[model samples]
Target: MGLPGEMRVVEISGPGGPEVLVPAVRKVPQPAAGEILIRVRAAGVNRPDLLQRAGSYAPPPGASDLPGLEAAGEVAAVGAGVSRWKVGDEVCALLPGGGYAEYVVTPADHALPVPEPLGMIEAAGLCETFFTVWSNVFERGRLTAGESLLIHGGSSGIGTTAIQIARARGVRVFVTAGTEAKCHACLELGAEMAINHREADFVAAVKDATGGRGVDVILDMVGGDYLPRDVRALAPDGRLVMIAHQKGAEVSMNFSLVMVKRLTITGSTLRPQSVEAKARIAEGLFREVWPLLDTGRIAPVIAESYPLEQAAEAHARLESGQVAGKIILEVA
Candidate 1:
């Protein structure tokens, strides 16, 4: 595809609060080799998006500085050496950065065909949460059938996705939420146990639910003080995958627990991953996970959708930490 002269995009002029996000018309990006140009219809606002805006998370070198990470749109054009997708394909993609725009370019390998039942809003909501869960919890953590998985922040996008994925695979899921209502919502989504973190110790509740066996895997986004409790909640030979440290990153924890239990700890970020790595993930999802999506075994849970221009308001809602599922930005 040939280059475009200009585009409309949401730009973060500086590191600051949500007020810093501005919608502006800029030069439209051209699709390079192995890339495709998408006329984005919707974009997903994720926790990392906020972190990037706050200056704590920076896009890797050569990636776009724009804040959005996941998007669903129709392909406008395809670059040289790309054959799998062509112009007019309705696709959703996991982008490293630069998704908050009317038109954005992504590696063709990262563009996935949207499941027929999912609309643009739902498709846009898929990438970040699902990618994070599939990579960290399922792939790295090696969560298996009949095993127990505990996810912190059950009401948010990642938590909701993890709960559903684990449940679909026949694993018993336990989640922690800030309120009784959130806990109830997690149970409604098929979680075996939903603990109110504000009122109960998740360690005790999970231990009780598992009959002292502890959980086999944990998807923890809250770092800092939760680290010790997470280790305490894990079973022998368990895995704990840390995706973020919303409270704080650094913490002091005992080494004896890890050594004695033989727990595995690892994590990966989608944005900085190479094209080949993302392609592998896309392939794995298409073969193993997409069928589940089409069969209605797993679905995107969208809590709200805001017009692309009201992104600031969307950010405010996400910052409140009260959303029940994924928040979306409708670009069209």
Candidate 2:
């Protein structure tokens, strides 16, 4: 069957709030060389999407203006030089941008087969957080088996993923959440300790849990005031990978503390990364993590889902701070 001439999409109608995500129609994107077009079934809502909508983050040059970083769907077309996927293959891909539509195009290597255990909605939430965590927590942070790790935003999609993967790999996991319920959720997800940040300082709790040695690695998204405290919570030779600074990026911190602790502070935002870099992350996930997912040892935690047209509502829900996991928009 021939493809449609146009498809439904939600565009960022100028920078503002959720209401700026308005419904529209656009021509179905054609797959370029080594690229594949996906007929999107569902898309994940992420903090980066919110930032893009707010005008703080802009789509990379030559990328779509739409605001989606991950999506799951079936192959609708395959571009020249693409061999790994064909039309109708179900895939969930780490997209550079332009996922907020009925169809989207991305490099073939950036797409992975939707694990046998996950459906479209579940798979939609996989790429962004999984890629982020795997790269930041394991590759950049150099977290290893038998080490201790601390994750901020323990109830978030990235936090839940890091908990399971770390536990499965024999790393002790600790997490911080704003509420008791969120803490409980993290604990259930294999965190050895979930500290309710509202009740106790995470640094002190992690130090106490680790017998005052501090953790080996810290994955933080909240910058601002938490910066110096993150330093205090690290063991000697610890690594801190900052993937997001939701509170604000500019902050005062003690570099001397970082130097004395022999800490490595590094971070990467996925969107601006090269396609080859993301492909490497995808390869790592397939080699090391897919089996756990296939066996149900780890799964995507979906907090809520809304129909495609209700993207505004979905964004509002995610920004509401009540969601403990990923929010999805079902497009199929």
Candidate 3:
């Protein structure tokens, strides 16, 4: 099949709000060596996309200015030295940028076969959150079986994924959400406990829950005021992995507590990582996590989906703080 010379896309018209995500068209991207061009069937909406739209984030060097970070589709073309996939293979991939289009190009190593019995919509939601969770929670945080983890945003895409993967591997999971309904959703997804942060202090709750031992690790997205509280919520040698700061980033943190508790504080943004590093994460997902997805042990909790053209609406839904899981943009 011949690839189109141009394709449809939703580009950031300006840096402000969800209304800036306007439908447009762009030339279809072509794959380079070790890359594959995908006819994108669906794209996942994430917080990073929101940041990019708000002019707070920018695509890494040599990446498209488009906002999306992950997508699922069929392989339309393969570049030189790309033999792992062929034309017509279905895959979900972690993109550097440019997923909000009908076509996108990403390294072949970043793409994985669509897991059994799941279509493009679910597959589209897989790579970004799974990669973030695996690299942050397991590799960086060193969370292991029998350990206890406290996730700050339990109802989010990353939170839900972390809960399932940690639980499936024998780790106990706890999460904090803003609402009771969100708490229930997290509980249903294998979280051992769900704390409504709006009603109670998470630090107190964690200390009480663990008999004052605190948690083995904390996956925190809320920074600022939560830093001091998180220090109080961790056990000796506990790890805290921050993936974002919905709250402000600047904080007056006391290193004394960190030293006394022997704690580790770290965080990462997935978009700017090297392709080689991302490929390693992809390998881990294929070996350790794909089976769970294939067997239906854990699935993408799709809160809602919108047509490709309704990207503004999708972004609005995500920002509304009412969504429990992923928001997908259907392209095909």
Candidate 4:
């Protein structure tokens, strides 16, 4: 795998909207030890990319500064100490950043084989959302069989992943989406009940769905005001794993609710986590979830794909908050 001279990338010139993503050509990257170079076929567009564009979320220390976090393609080359994968292996990876380009370098351990059942586009869309949900909701939150899991934004990438993974594990799911249509989409994907947050109070609806017992775990992306209602909606010993603070991070909430229910609150970002920590999660996912993908029990729901040159449009679509599932960019 001889390295190419240069690769085309969609880059953010400065802090601003989607229009700020400008196309540029840069020297192809060389993989460091334990890293692999991928000929990027496609990249996933996520909310964090939008935030990075606005200068709200910067790349974690030592991670790539470019925007895309998930991508799928073939391993064109491998660096020293990379024994598990070789050149020409079809792989998809959860990149820390630098995916909105023709080629991106990633730690070989973060790369997973794309199942033959899933095409490159769908594989491109899996890494970020599935890794996030598997780590936060199941691994950390401890969602169990016969237990109930509540997910916010049920039609978004993470929401959709949580729904399928929980369902496959025999856990009942309740999700909140913005519209009846989105709610119905969640139901079709296996949620026990889909609440239209705009038309009904999710707290009451969740209670009703569980016979007033409340859900066992909640995977929340909305912070601030949702914190209180999330507490009210928990079952005894339940967990609320907050992943993002889209509504805002600060909140005034009662501690008694947390104490009375014996609730646990925790969250983590993949980029900032130590490599050893992520490697642990990757192992768990490999043992429990990878087989599902191998057998087709779980797969990514790709809502749309845009060309690399149209990267700005992909960001704009994500900002609209109307995408049914993961939106991806084709690097070619």
Candidate 5:
């Protein structure tokens, strides 16, 4: 199929709230060498998109100002030297930006073939959270079989994926969510225990669930006070991987506990990383996670979806803190 001369996209009209996301038409983007132009069928709404809309996070240099970070679609065009994909191949990809458009260009290596059982809509929500969880929870946190993990925000996309993937690998999974319903959802996704943070103290709950040994790994998004609590929740030689600071960045924690526990604390932001680094992550995901997806051992959990023109509403829903899984924007 031939490409269009222009495509519709959701642009950040100004830095503010979800209402700032407005629909606009732009000239179709051409992929440079090593990139491919995708005809976007759907896009995933992420917390970073909200941060970008609020002017707290900015796209990296040379990336699109559009907010979406993941998309699923068919290849429409390929740039020179891009041999991995051609017209009509269906794929889902982790994008630097610009997924809110009807068409997007990304490094060919960032795109992966959609799992056999998933359609474009569900596949659309896979890239961002899956990549983050795989890179942080498994690679950085070093969670392995026979170990245990504590996941904050357990009903969100990242939490759900981590829960299933870790469980599939024989790792015990514990999670904390904002509501009882969300907690139950996490448990249904193979978590060994799910604590409702609004009603229970997660640190206490995790300690009790682990018989006071504490967990071996923690995937934390809420920083601030959580930093100290997370420290208290880890066992000796444990790892705490911080991905976001929804609470706040600054914190006061006991250095003595960190030293005594021999814990490791680390984090990373995916969009700003080099193409080679992301390609390495993509390779790992394809080799390890994709087979699990194909076998139905792991999957994307879609909470809701909206039309491309209603991108603002999708963002609003994501910001509402009521969604239990991923939110998608249907473009095609």
Candidate 6:
């Protein structure tokens, strides 16, 4: 099949609000060696995308300035030296950038086959959150089966995925969300208890839930004052993985707790990592988490979707902080 010369994309006209994302046409990118061209069907809207749109996060060198980080689609073309996939194969992938377009090129190894029971739309929401949760909650945090985990932002895409995946692996999951409805949604998705952060003290709740021993690991996206509480909420040798600082990055926390408890503090951002590193993460997911998705033990929670042109409105919805899960853009 012949490829189209031009494709539609959502571009950041200027760094500002969601209204800056405007539709425009651009030449379809050709995949280079070790890369594959994907005819994008859907793209996920993430917090990083919002940061990029607002000029707080810049795309790394050689990455497209477009604002999407993950997408699902069919392979449209294969570049030289690529072997795992060919035209017409369905895939969901983590991208360095450029997922907002109708066609995107990414390292072939970064893409995973769409799970058996999921379509392009749902698969679109899978890569970013799953890869993030796996890398942080399991790999970095070292959360193992039979341990307890505390997840902040439980109603979020990352939180929802982490809750289910951790629960499926025999890890008890506790979560904190901003509202009662969001907390309930987290509980329904396998969280042992969902604390309404706005009303309840998460540190106290976690301590109470774990019999005052504290959780074994915590996946925190809300930084700021929560850092001290997160430190206090961990059991000895517990791991605290920070992925974002929505509340604020700076904090004043007592180091005595960290040292006395022997807690581990770590964090990572997905987009800036090297291709080889991300490919390794993809492999891990293929072996460990994909089966859960295939068997219906876990799944992506889609809050809403918008047409590719209405990317601005989608951003508005996400920024409203009312969404319970992933937001997506339907491209094809």
Q: Any runs in candidate 1 off by more than 4 Å, and if so which?
A: 1-4
Candidate 1 lDDT: 0.89
Per-residue lDDT tens digits for candidate 6, residues 202-242, read 88998988889999999999999999999999999999999
TM-score of 1: 0.97
* CA lDDT, every model vs. true structure: 0.89, 0.93, 0.94, 0.91, 0.93, 0.95
Model 6: weakest 10-residue lDDT segment is 202-211
lDDT, candidate 3, at 106: 96
lDDT of 4: 0.91
What's each prediction's TM-score?
0.97, 0.98, 0.99, 0.98, 0.99, 0.99
Q: For model 5, how does the per-residue alpha-carbon lDDT over 1-332 read when each residue is reduced to its tens digit?
A: 46779999999999998889999999999999999999999999999999999999999999999889999999999999999998999999999999999999999999999999999999999999999999999999989999999999999998988998999999999999998899989989999899888888888988888899999999999999999999999999999999999999999777899999998999998888999999999999999999999888889999999999999899889888999999999999
Writing each residue's lDDT as its tens digit, candidate 1 over 266-307 gives 777777788898888888788878888877888988999998
Better of 2 and 3 by lDDT: 3
Q: Report how far residue 140 has shifted in candidate 1, in Å.
A: 0.6
Worst 10 residues of 1 by lDDT: 1-10
Clash pairs (backbone) in predicted model 1: 6-27, 6-28, 7-28
* Superposed Cα RMSD, model 6: 0.6
Tell me model 5's lDDT, rounded to 2 decimals: 0.93
| Candidate 2 residue spans exceeding 4 A from truth | none
**Model 6 lDDT, residue 49, Cα:** 93
Q: Count the backbone clashes (under 3 Å) in each candidate.
A: 3, 0, 0, 0, 0, 0
With a 3 Å backbone cut-off (N, CA, C), the pairs that clash in candidate 3 are none
